[model samples]
Target: MSRRPYKPVMSKTWYLKQPSYRNYMIREMSSVFIGLWTLNLLIGLGKLIQGPATWSQWLALQAHPLMILFSAVTLALALYHSLTWFRAVPQVMRIQIGTSFVPAKLITNAHIGAMVGFSAIVLLATLWGV
Candidate 1:
């Protein structure tokens, strides 16, 4: 007699069952938006390379209400992805000094601080047309 191996079934939304699992799923999903945003940027670059008319059209397309909304959503997801990534850094990276390891909060806070500082610099430069 041949016996079939039993396979356990799980819910499609099993990730929603636990807070950690849900967060993990959300973080993973955010990558899709980030990737799409990056793809949009690449397309814009290609349009720019195609010359002034194409570039202007691409810029106009970005100015549309739907594109504006999409940018806002993408920005939010990117921020969430960055924060979660910073939080995970300390867990994955063990930075040791003598007999002690760096605190997770310190590592995460440093990353956040650097991000803010760089963002401010970029904003200033953009505003100043640098």
Candidate 2:
């Protein structure tokens, strides 16, 4: 194999049409951003699992004003991501319940219902079933 010098030659037109350029910049941007926030969530979980002291420390950190502000932003973005994921479940897995073809919207709504129900269960458990 002959060795060739790597030239830093660039062309705007070619880069514009490059699939990597489009995929890297546009299609995967939000996924990457959410991936970052997901990492944060995992780290938070890890800290919480360390023990009550660590978990309380993390909770106090969250109550700080700036953290609270960013938490609000990430919360909204996460909700948007969750809804998008839930909406795609029906498309990804078509359900045939019993003898009829269930609609995609109905399946998506069921997914949303399950999510809400799970949240309610947690809330009720926290409240000691009052």
- Best-matching candidate per TM-score: 1
Residue 2 shift from truth in candidate 2, angstroms? 21
**Local distance difference test, each candidate:** 0.94, 0.76
Which structure among the candidates has the greatest lDDT? 1
Can you write out model 2's per-residue Cα lDDT over 62-127, one digit (the tens) per residue? 789987777676666666666777877887888787988789999889989998899899999989
What TM-score goes with each of the models?
Answer: 0.92, 0.56
Task: Count the clashes in each prediction.
Answer: 0, 0
Model 1 misplaced stretches (Cα beyond 4 Å): 1-3
Cα lDDT for residue 104, candidate 2: 90
